[model samples]
Target: MLAARASDDGALADAATGQSEGGVRWAAFRQGLVTNVLNPKSIVFLVALLPQFLTDRSTWADKSVLGAVTVLMVFVWFCAVSLAVGAFQRVFRRPGARRALNIATGLVLIALALVIVLTG
Candidate 1:
């Protein structure tokens, strides 16, 4: 998830720096979503992680409810991130700004990965 977020951020940063048009922005967003949704590992992760939280009472109806909640959460998170990144588009348009943002995001992702690894 963090990696996906970083990629989204990187794309946004690139757009900001390059003055990308609406079509470009839409393409980037679609690419990011596809990259994330099509990842096989993500399916494996959902299979592994969600089942751990499943209960004996988790019938098909319950599963559907949980699935809906999960989808809603993802929607909210992406919307928030998109809005936040859009707000910074002008700031990231300056030369070197996008590079710095990428570096910072990369560092954050690395740090998060390390923490997950060490904790797990």
Candidate 2:
């Protein structure tokens, strides 16, 4: 997808950078929602980390409060990131900028793949 977007100068490229005329892309939004919801790493990390802040006598109420706080913190972090990205949406919408970004992202993914292959 990044490779295709890098060379595209049409609707596909535009949509890739959230430049669709009809506004939000529900399909992509749904995909992202599903991916985040089903991410086991987050679940495992929270399960492992949260217990460190509690004791053997910790009540259910205490656990609930801590879980709520963690969720709130994650929500705030995502909101801040979304706002930061939205602020730069105009720059990303530019053809040259989008192309460069897509190429850079593609290179980053390739580098990550190489690292995984070499390490494993």
Candidate 3:
């Protein structure tokens, strides 16, 4: 969302179609949180994976605390990633900068594809 706002191309979906930048970020957070909570894949993974660490004495409270901690860690990591990406966007949001980046990215992708095809 921040990247799109930072770009001249207007590529990102308006997760928050509002008057303020904070609103957009809040919307993005809510969307991500709700999506993660509702996603069956995540639930299945958590159910399947979290139990490996459990012992016979582990209770629901223990699971809840672990889940909360896991969620907090994920949120912190997300914040860091968003901040880094947002800072980069702020630096390279100009039309000319975006064009240069696009060209570079395209060239890199083409080179990678060529390398894969040639080597494989």
Which structure among the candidates has the greatest lDDT? 2
Residue lDDT tens for model 1, 1-120: 223343343344444667557777787789879987898997888888788778997899888887788878887998899899779878876545766766788898899889999999
lDDT of each: 0.75, 0.78, 0.76
Lowest lDDT block of 10, candidate 2: 5-14
Model 2 per-residue lDDT tens digits across residues 13-84: 444676664445555456666887789998899889999999999999999999999989987887798789
> Which residues of candidate 1, in runs, are more than 4 Å off?
1-22, 103-120
Q: Rank the candidates by lDDT, best first.
A: 2, 3, 1
Error of 3 at 92 (Å): 5.5
Runs in model 3 deviating more than 4 A are: 1-8, 11-18, 91-120
Model 1: colliding residue pairs: none
Candidate with top TM-score is: 2
TM-score of each: 0.62, 0.70, 0.61
Superposed on all Cα atoms, model 1 deviates from the true structure by an RMSD in Å of 6.7
